[model samples]
Target: MYTIKYRVPESARSGQSARSEEKWYHVSILTQYTCTSTGASNKKRLHRKQYCIATTKSSQLENLRSEFGLPVVMDPIGNGNCQFAAVSYHLRQYGIHRSEETLRQEVVTFLRQTPVLGNRICGANWWTSILKQPRNNLSRMSTEYEYGDQITLQAMSQLNNMQILIVSTRNSATTLISPDGSSCLSSRYPLIILGHYPEGAGEHYVALGYKRHALERIVDKSAQVTWETDPPTSDDDLNVGGDDLSAGGDNLSAGGDDLNAGGDNLSAGGDDLSAGDDDLSAGGDDLNAGGDDLSAGGDDLNAGGDDLSAGGDDLNAGGDYLSAGGDDLSAGGDDLNAGGDDLSAGGDELSAGGDDLNAGGDDLSAGGDDLNAGGDDLSAGGDDLSAGGDDLNAGNYDLSAGGDDLNADGDDLNACDLGSPNTSDITRLREMVQFKRNRKHVHQNRHVILPREIWCIIVDIVLKLSPLSRYSLQRVNRMFRDLVGKTPPPRLYLCPSRFGDVTVSPISVRKIIALSGSGSGLVQAIRQLIRHSSWVNAWLFLRLATLCGWYTVEGIWYRRKRRN
Candidate 1:
């Protein structure tokens, strides 16, 4: 028998008390073990509070509020229990695809598709099959989960401990499931369309984010821009996008817009300079656009490769307007540019297969709606797999929309870019923040504390930044002393400087701002920033000729102050 236990951080609790920072009883995960059953063997207990229709339940919950001090109290019952299949699954590790995200997204996709497996087993049960284990070669961390094992049946039998928030159900007419066998997820996940069931073949699980037998879409010519760049970054992302579309709402997207295969350590998206190399590498594989308008999208500029990214040996590294709107939209479809990266499209409505494959061979294009069964897609978010379509046996890079039969190649892996500062980027951010925090601990108060030499290198990395973000980072620690003036980065002198550019002054700042805000949309954007800024009161006082009485007096006063 095996088990998995996780203590939710106190920081994760939703209660008003310190509970927020102390969540211990997180989800119970049965990892590490997978057993087959002929008769009862290695029995285990599963526990969690269950809720049912009852007002008295709230009172009971409130009473226990002091017992655990949890914010959202369980009602009616406390600690409901259930059982599972006799086996723990092949709890062994298998070298999954290079990117860990592939495995992560795969598991998430499977979970999202068939979220619940509720069936009950009895006092006695037996089985002899342990089909696909999580582990292939054999190691820990790889186990298998069977649909209806007597163990799971028995587990579900303890009604008081289990709760199935049914995303979908079988035999809905009869509310409660009371079979001592298997009740595979009966409904279809979003975008997935399953055929009718055979007499008694039980439920078949699929990590399908795309609908089955869905019709291929035909897009218009105008939308078919050969390939361009897009650079739309939000000044504040967390606060801009729609609230309901967050991780909580529509909790189950086609299961992905993101995927990660194990191994290749997707720590970085760059080809020559993978993010894994230097957490601070500037070699951008996946272009950062902030979803802004055409400044620079993921369309990795290569000599030729088309479809997803232009060129690069990473996934989801190209395309200008990839959206996670639908699995149909190209997400990370440009990562493996086999053409040279991975470019697997397979989004809904927007099915444009393998166009930007870094093929430098041809101006690779998935031609709008060019339906190639399992072909690459130049479209979709989290779908970039820039490589040219390799053989299915060899892990094909890009697989555009499926066919009328809707059956994804069993072994294929489709990656989805995890949004901004991708997972690896997040790790980098955390590292930077920690570095600053640590520097503070070592260097307390002093007239001038010299940040470690390493910090000097770190600060230099960000010198190109505008005062806006730089100012924010400076306040992070006393280590920022040498950054601005004191210990000016020697690299500052290395920056491209010219004698003729001595004109760059506060007035130049105003002119640049004004010029950018003129006739073009670029100028308007700057104006918007200035108008909305409630912080800096600084502005250029453009003094025109004194018009009349008031103007003449104001001009005279301005001249006095200027002279002083």
Candidate 2:
């Protein structure tokens, strides 16, 4: 078993930031709760397969009792990696510790050379296989089940120079096997065990880093034995180091007259010197090299004959010089011009007239966007007009006038210009045409001429019915009879002797008559049939009835007329 420093925030006074305080705890693969002396009711526990978990709660140092609270087990919330955590905890117990990142790097380094481990790293299968053998030979290996104690022992043995061995079954023990073929019993120390229990199968591994004696002795108090390793003595073994120079100290030297005491001027000899005004002439010049003129512009004497004028302007010598004393013109360089209130002539010329002749060069121009010639002596008579330029003037022309006659329309229109029309006019125009058109009148009363085949079908249906139905269709109106006049109605003779024969009666008429009544019932039944049939069928039935009635009347009339 091993111990690691778990840091918790020390609760601060009101309105203060929390400070962190370190607490040493016996950490391993085994499930345990975190105990505090403040109250066991609020102390939370960690379950199996979890070595390090952070809590937001700021736990004070007072909550930990070295005897009972430090190694309290908490509820487990993680899945798998129990064996890895336990082995890691065991290493930490022996003063050799690796962080999670370092552990991952070591595993990757070990797996890279082993071709039989395939491309994957740190999965369940690879861990299981490595735990079982812990040797370089990875041929025909199986990484199926959870790693047992033997596999973990083998893996730990192969990991470092330290020898590790596991005791399984009835007397499960841990032994620190050494390199010199010597073994020491480590059962007193908490051992990481992998086993199945009554609660579940496929059991996970658990680690208890501290020894049994240490665990018992430090029961109620926080564990505080230093778990850090000392630094190695050899400088060659270190990756970084400091030089011989110490920090926070200056190392400088000054020699001879180069070192000034404390004044602005360097005065090494113990002579009184005036070091004010950033000048050393009083101390260095005993012969009065600057003389009494030093108090009044003495440096101007050695300034290449530069004058100290009252205006403080430098005298112009040559090369585009502007005379600062007066406005004296020079004539050598490109900008050799005199400076004054107004420059009449240099590279360009200028002239001004008194009355209204604002002339600069040779021409008195009658030109501008708004020209004004009160005397009307404008000479430029006919020139094409450019924008904003003066108009051409002829004899007795009022070209210099600035009034309504010169008001050229400034309302220039572009391609997308919209005219300023009145809002009321636009509204009235929209109201004159704004409405939905009446489409229902045209749709409701439209003429639709049907096809010839439909009319022929109506007549054909009228021809296939019995005489009684034909007479009933004729009673509908004259128009229906004219429509069915193309086809004659079917003759349906009712004879009780030939009732079952096909020629005696039509099936439709026979069924209607049979289903109805015989004798006087036939009349009302036939009338019902006329009402029930379609227009075409009733027309055909009426025609058939007319034929049958005519035959009977003709036979009776012929016999009576012959007897008379």
Candidate 3:
């Protein structure tokens, strides 16, 4: 069996950061575990293919120790990579062994300086097959997954210092997290945590470079990617250096699942996820979970524990590269897929005609509830994906939340801009209002963008807000400002009189036009409008009225619904 570890290097380059990241390497050993009432059903040990069996990772790991009769196993938490051993080596080489304390202080200084950002790199988790356990079928009397609750890195973010997972089994899918921020799942509140697979790692991984020879070479070749193969071996030699590390072949060690060779890709620090190959046929699942590049697929079919395909249910890729058909045939039930290219939830609850669809890919469609989000780069989508009560953010561009609750966490957002030539479905209420409004709202306003006709709705909403609010709106985003600037909102959207000052005297309009030209994000220059408007209210309507107006600062229109 093998294990992946990380080591710190004595070095330079200081910036505002600390804590480097480690890579999760797969060190395949025998499986061991503790039997729970749901042992065989654990999904953690299902790969054993033992039916009616129930066990835990602790049990599985033990079982392996017994089978192989090996006493030492690799530990990521221990003196990682034996790097400490090289300290003396370094001293001997530089003739400074006498200054050990100096070296230690130097290392500590490095960790604290601006260069050491607060552990910017942290190991993610290992990817395992979803089928490792008897997928807790949806039929079990005691069910887990529920409605309204989803697995989002953001939602899970509140689960700090914990491990979580979103997986599909036999024909069931669910997301589990440690509610208390402890790494255990509560079968009762499946939402709390998916529980632990026992043997699932509790340590961090440091990323080392991948083994560039035999295995990785072949895997890369299969994907049509070019790479230089060092001391490569032919395909017929799987057994040549398979178990023999000393056989002189560079091995792919992101161990638990094989990523380079279609297995589980290991997790490394720095939020760098080493994923297996996720495709229409297979997906990846995080046996354990952590930060960024948080979830994807495995190398081999389902190696990452995110089984991409629904067991050949049908062709899943819906021409979106991220969409595929997975039949969740349980009556009133659904098939859910969470990983694929360009798939996302827009951080909302997305449900398909079927049931749930969680995706990491984009430009896709689903029939189940979908939620695409994971701080700066999280994408969750599906036919009815709903960011209902959660975050729907696109840390960057070209992100679409096809179902509902399309939102913007930090970036100015485009909700349901799906009616265009190249967008996904705006399935919330099965309508595309936001989709259209986002497309067209860019043009109606003065100096704005005009792409489609639907944007008028947003323009309508923005128009109803107080002038100060409207001005502050520019600070929401540079892109939104740029786009909305091109496509002005519809003039009739708001009653214009709602804000009383929305259509102030002639000179005010020009001032607003000019203000619109100057800002992006959080109250920009328009924030000063609050001060100006407040004084006007004080002089005309009196202090109480001014306070009343200030209270509506979120948007004057928000106080009353926009006109039809």
Each prediction's whole-model lDDT (CA): 0.26, 0.32, 0.31
lDDT of 1 at 83: 11
Sliding window of 10 residues with minimal summed lDDT for model 1: 549-558
Best candidate (score: lDDT): 2
Question: Each prediction's TM-score against the native?
Answer: 0.16, 0.18, 0.17
- Sequence-dependent TM-score of model 2: 0.18
User: How would you order the candidates by lDDT, starting with the best?
Assistant: 2, 3, 1
Query: Residue 208 error for model 3, in Å?
Result: 21
User: What is the TM-score ranking, best to worst?
Assistant: 2, 3, 1
Candidate 3 residue lDDT tens string, 1-564? 576563433345597455566654454421232233356575655555444232333564454332222221321112221222122122222222322223333333332332212223542211121232222311221121111122222222231222233221211222323333333222211111121111233222111211225224233333222222333354322222122111012233332554352221122321222223221221355432243333344433333433334334332233222333442222112323343323444543345433354433333443233433212122222223444443333323223444444432222244534444223343332233334434444543548554422353365355455443444556777644542343222121112234344323222322333444435322343344344543322211111112222322222221233798
Q: Write the per-residue lDDT of candidate 1 for residues 427-468, one digit (tens) a residue.
A: 333234334434554554435544344454466565544323
- Compute the lDDT for candidate 1: 0.26
Candidate 2 residue runs with Cα over 4 Å from true position: 1-78, 90-149, 161-183, 186-202, 209-564
The regions of model 1 sitting more than 4 angstroms off are 1-55, 73-309, 312-564
Best TM-score among the predictions, by candidate number:
2
- Per-residue lDDT over 1-564 for candidate 2, one digit per residue giving the tens place of the 0 to 100 score: 788777767888799888998877777422253433434543433331133322211231112212122232221112334445455555554434543224434544544443333212432444454434534423222231223333334334434323333222112222333222234322211223222121253343443322334433332122222111332234322111111111112221121122222322122121122222243322222212212223223222112233432244444343444344465434343232323233222323222111121122223222332222222222111211111233222222223321112111122211112222212232222222121112332443497765434554565565454433444565676655644443343323344343333323223444534544444454353454354544212211122233222111000001122564
Distance (Å) between predicted and true CA of 270, model 2? 70
Error of 2 at 296 (Å): 80
